[model samples]
Target: MAVLGAVGGLLAALGLLAFGLYCCYVRYIHAKYDHIPGAPRESFIFGHLPILWRMLRKQEFMHDLFLQWAEKYGPVVRLNAFHRVSLMIVSPEGVKEFLMSPQYSKDPLVYGRVFSIFGERFVGNGLVTVCNHEHWHRQRKIMDPAFNRNYLIGLMETFNEKAEELMTKLEEKADGKTEFSMLTMMSRVTMDIIAKVAFGLELNALSDDQMPLPRAVTVALEGVTKTRIPFIRYMPWKQKLIKEVKESVRLLRRVGKECLDQRREDIRNGKEVTLDILTQILKGDALEETRDDENILDNFVTFFVAGHETTANQLSFTVMALGQHPEILERLQAEVDDVLGAKRDIDYEDLGKLTYLSQVLKESLRLYPPVLGTVRWLEKEHVINGVRIPGNTMLVLSTYIMGRMERYFKAPLTFNPDRFSKDAPKPYYCYFPFSLGPRSCIGQVFAQMEAKVVMAKLLQRFEFQLVPGQSFKLVDAGTIRPLDGVMCKLKPRSCAGSCQA
Candidate 1:
């Protein structure tokens, strides 16, 4: 009995020592951002975690939650996730400093999530997710010419062709009664555009229902979003999910490999190739060090994924906002008619001429940016708005939150396209739908151009109204899109030459 008692006493002492060490470690982890303000912590171990998880589970607007925290804790709010800390910055000076400079690299852990999915390298070193600064520079330099004005202008035909296909599909249900998800329609059209224009393959997703590629891409993206939650990998019942995700990943990579190989063979055989992204990827292949076959396929998947979903969501948001605001809708339609007229194909110059449509698109992005924001990891400590940001800290620069803040936008909740008119002063750091600086989305011009073509055609051909009892809320599944998919009932436009909403 005495020996057992002594053993218990020693165990207690060891437990006390371990508890003391844990306290010290927790303090050390939190000391980095103790100075920054934030919502009151729930617990040191899971600072602000319970609230975030609750929000996620309830399908609440996580971006709005960020704005509320910013309002309570001031512009620079520090948030803790497990042992790591993330600082949310909304100030213009800080956004400029953090995003404009090359010194602040992307958070590899966050980006590295995109670098793979379920133990598979998915976007492997692609331009959008690659963290190596020098490697990204080499890839970007070679691909810049493809997105240049001359090249995008050449893509106008592909845009019009795919969008017209969508119009034909919409016509079947354009009887002024049937409700369809406009986002579903737009998603198909945009994916088709990416496949045809960027990849030189006809996806025909707009007209076909059984395209395995589209479903594979969707499943793969869902897998990417799942990877964000670290615990999902260990869920005992997720074996089937793991299999589907892996199959989806392998399917995309296998298809990408075939495309890459065929294109390479064509180039070698002296066969003509279109001026598309595949061509640019081949051109970049001249740099032998970066020309690994897997690397080439990484870009193939990267462009297809990034180039499709975001624009579809943005187009759907613009349509939703327009359906809500009749006056703005009328103005956009008038502008589209005046600029595009009865012309089947919209010229690149006419795109700039549709000024009101441009404003509407910008306004839509402000409220519902497809990509809410991006993250950066600063190399050293810095101060912004008089608050010290620690070195090696994860920073979230959220355009979605900033767009709705009263300080950044007047009457922030209202859907006002006039705010983005040419006469209206430009938002400096508060607006970045395509992001800002060197790391901005490479497909910006291509995306906007495609949007104009589709938006203009939709206005010219049909009048759309949102289905009743459907709430317009945002859903964040890797990217932010309308939760309800923007259901709409369409009527064939009676007055194509001069339609008024």
Candidate 2:
């Protein structure tokens, strides 16, 4: 009994020692080296997790929290979460350095899993996810032709057609109704645009039954966003989620293959192939020649997934914003009416004349960029803003926060389209709706053209007003969307004459 008691005593002593050592280790990590600036450290074990969680749940605006941190801790702030050290850079100068610097690369851990689920070959080091210097350069060179001015001009008819269909559908839905979810209508329209542009197929998803292809693709995308959470991919629930994602990916792959096969058949038969993005990609001998069938399919999937979701969110928000501010909407209506002026279709040439419409879209993007933030990992140890950051540190730049900074804009919170006017003062790095630099969004032009086309047609045909007492709160899902839905009343605007709300 005495021996056992002594052993227990020794074990207790050892436990106490270990506990003391752990506390010391934590203190060491939490201890601010003069080299590291700005971020307040919490208890070593929890680090910044609690602060982040609280801010995430309670703060309606996350950008505000980051901005506050920047104000308190300087432009660069250090945070530790999930045993990973992170640096948040708020200054435009810092952002420019990182985005432009070749040293910074897409964090593989974050994007690798995304690529894995989407299938490795289809993404084939595509522009959105790839990091390798040589690979990205090659991919960018090959993909550049698809976004040329001539091709975009060619796509104008399709954009107008889709927009007309959208307007007509909304008008029909608002026949007796005071308000409907214009947000949903816009989502469906953008999805249809992406389908037609990328695949040479007009899904017409706005009016049609939910197609299996888009539905599966959306599900897979949702899975990827959730799986990005640390260790969530390993959980049983997440494993099942991943399983569903894999199944959805397989379905999408099959659909993509079918589409490609059809295109190939048309090519072989000497039928005039559509001048859509997919056709252009297939015809381009540079990348497609070296890429396999699966790689090509991955690229298509990537394009569809990235292209649709971001634009859909932007379009939805733009409509919601215009609806909330009737004056802006009224002005937009007048502009569209004057520009199109009873034209059955808005041709490519007319787009240049619709400068006001472009300004509204630009302002909306500035207010709420489709991508709130992007993460990039440091490939080498680097100093940012006089702080030493070790290699592999996760660096985050919140475009949402950056867009709202007073340093970047005057009256940052207000929704003013005039800021982007021809005579208005421009600030460097102030607007990055599609991001800036070589790694910027490849489909930006396509997205803008589609939004303008849709918005113009809707303004020409219908007038929208925000529903009273309806909260249009921004919910951060894959993209920012209304927490409930964007419930708005629509009254058709007759082109023959102006009508009051």
Candidate 3:
């Protein structure tokens, strides 16, 4: 019996030893991109994950760290978090090659994380989260007509109306002493616009603070962001937040289901439904061999989340940037005054003439792009920027990092709108706020039009000042937004109705 026990103990010890060696191999020795330059590994087992976690814990702008690393480690840098390896690609050549080609698909590991939040299906196989090339292509092709030129041009009235509603809301608070969160206001307005335009439902988020959709969308995004943390579900103190997140996601799906059902009923009843986003989604589903009800809900939720939050973040950041630079704000206001001339409803032609205003918005996007970047999976080995990157590698392309790199922009930190002037050289492959290639955002034109209307009206009517002592730093939610919500005090401009620029 003693000999038998000794044999068993020896086997168990050997098994543990084997497991430990395997872990060491996976974490350290098995690194495929070690030849690529990067900061020294901060952990034997976790790689650079600890540093990332530390940055998250400290509420640091994590992208800023990536920017610093890019400067130190060149364009193609390596990063490891546990068994997963990613190469940060900031070089123009890498960007052009990987993003422009359809062969490089989205990394499932990167996008699949958002498919479900804590086991509740969030954006399940939606256009944004689907990694399969054929699937995404099918979805994108069907949805393209909804965002075509005439369709977006038709949305201008909805954009102007919702933006005007926002102007009305701001008038009540434009006392020069009342402090308000510009982000919250922008979020509400954009939510109203998207809900009405996409779903044909009046969310009225601008007038109603108690609206459920806006709050649910925010909570759902928080849930998505929290999923990035390893074992976050197992944390003791996060139970309340986790529960809230689940509930929010469920609520969003429930709303989506109800909206889809109602739209289907409307179609059956021969109701004259406009060719809106929901209609496009239903039309897409009809063309498929087998209908996917969950995928439909996935798109429903996806549009609501994507259509609203990103533009809100963009507008809020633009407001924050303009508030900080009064001279730029003055110039923008002058242009708005000259073009708009107290015209409450801005025409499509007016948008073209707001050239400086366009520059200001473009510059704001360069500095504080709401959608930072994307991830692609490289299936085969490729040499980029004089470095041989291994196949089956996950590549991270960060607009946040590239936009701030001195190699790409002159005075990377400065908020200079002239960089986007008509004569200025366009950023080759470094600047893609809406991304590039076929997978680029379909709502780019829609978003920009809505932003212009809102911003143009804001410049026309209000003179806003940044509130003192608030952190102007960004918070990297699913999309980056002003950490402080862009607190501001506003007063109606001296020439609110008309200005002789």
Candidate 4:
């Protein structure tokens, strides 16, 4: 009996030893083959979750650390987060390759649920979320006309009108203040611009009273950003929050559908379709044959979400950067003064002449790009910078870190508009504010024009200076925003003379 008991114990011990050996072989031997260079790894169970959390908490200069990692490791590094392995690619060449590759697709698991709120008929398989190659091609062909240069030029009046209203609103708010949160103000302006341009609905978010549509959209986005945390996904409260978000989405869709239905009715009654994006999208001949209402709604939601948030954040960052650098602001103001003069209205043609303003906007985008990182999943195995990446790997390209890498630019940390001047030597893949290749942002020109008009108009009436004792730190949420909000004293500038206030 004693001998039999000893044998059973010996067998259990052997089983344990074999399992440990298997684990070591998988972790040390196999991992070396699959891993990218320079990326730190976590233990087999938890992976890099703790490291990622620490980096995320630091907030300030986190991008700098990412750049350092890129420099230490090769351009491509493999990081494990909560058992999920991710590839971080920092080189401009690598970024260009991944962004341009047809094999790479946006990870729907990361973006799908929030997008599903747009309803199955309108969003279930829309252009932004659809993966089928033929569908993408067809949708792109139909959507291209809406953002064409001629179409954008036609929208300039809408842009100008919104800008004028925004200036008046700012003047009222800044009557006695020297500093205000430009982030909040710019959010309002961009929301109003998008609402008017996209839906032919005038939503004056710049006013003190919150507009219902913008408020609902803001609530929905806030909820979406919160759900991104892994811990948040497990809580019961998360389910409740998601339910609330769906309700908000329903409200937003109801509003959108009402507007769309009204327009469609008008078209049927022989009224000519307006030049708004919604009009073009809903009534365009390109999509006339497609019976997918879900796809149409998806596109609408994509435009609504993508259209305002990043642009608004970019504008706010531009203002903060301008406030910090008085010389650049003064130069921009001079250009605005020279171009627009005392005229209250600036035409679309006049926007082209604001060369210095364009440069300033370009520089701001470089320093604090709206999107810090973009992720694409490989449909097939691929080699990036001589490193073999397996299929289904998430490739994360950090624009935020790349813009600050010394290898990419001279004095990359410094905000200098001169870098974009005609004499500046620029490499092809180094600077990609709007991304590159076939999948590049189709609305780049429109976004640039809108930013220029809004910034030009604001600079004409106000001189912004950073407020004292305010903690204006980057809050890297959905887009990089100021954690405490940007507090700046705005002194109204005379349109006719120097901005002495």
RMSD of 4: 4.8
Tens digits of lDDT, candidate 1, 328-395: 88887788777777777778888889888888899999999999889999778888999988888899
What is candidate 3's TM-score against the reference?
0.97
Which parts of model 1 are misplaced by more than 4 Å?
A: 1-20, 498-501
lDDT by residue for model 3 (1-501), tens: 999999999999999999898797775644577888988888866889889889888999888988889999977998886677789999999999988988999999888888899999999899988989999999998898888888888888998999999999999999999999999999999999999889998888898999887888888888888887888999999999999989999999998889899999999999999888899999999998998899999999899999999999999999999988999998898888889888999888899999998999899999999999999999999999999998889999988889999999999899999999989999989998988897889899899989999999999999999999998988888889899999999999999847553
Clashes of each: 0, 5, 0, 13
Per-residue C-alpha lDDT of model 4 across residues 1-501, encoded as one tens digit per residue: 999999999999999998788677556643644656755565665565666667665665465666778778758876665435677887777877888777677776655655554232224555656666576777677778888888888888888888888787777767556456777777888888888888777777887565766666666766655655566646886777666666777777677677777888888899977677687667543446655555566677767767887888888888888878888888888888888876666788888899888888888888888777667877677876788887767777777777877888788889999988878887456567777766677778989999988888788877777777766567666566667567767667754433332
lDDT of 4: 0.73
Q: Locate the minimum summed-lDDT window of 10 residues in model 2.
A: 492-501
Against the true structure, what is each candidate's TM-score?
0.95, 0.86, 0.97, 0.87
Error of 2 at 411 (Å): 2.2
Q: What is candidate 2's lDDT per residue for 1-501, written digit by digit as tens?
A: 999999999999999998888877766654533256655556466776767666555636455567777667757787775346678777777788888766678787766766766342334445677778777776677778889889888888788888878877876766546667766677677778888877877677887856676567666767665653556656775667677777887887777788888998899899997667678657653344474676677678888777877887787788778877878887888888778866767788888899998889888888878787677888677776666767767788777777777777888878889988899887566467676777888889888888877777777777676777877677566566665567777776654223321
User: Model 3 residue 108 lDDT?
Assistant: 91
Identify the leading candidate in terms of lDDT.
Answer: 3
Of the candidates shown, which would achieve the greatest TM-score relative to the real structure? Answer: 3
How would you order the candidates by TM-score, starting with the best? Answer: 3, 1, 4, 2
Model 4: per-residue Cα lDDT at residue 68: 76
The alpha-carbon lDDT assigned to residue 196 of candidate 4 equals 82
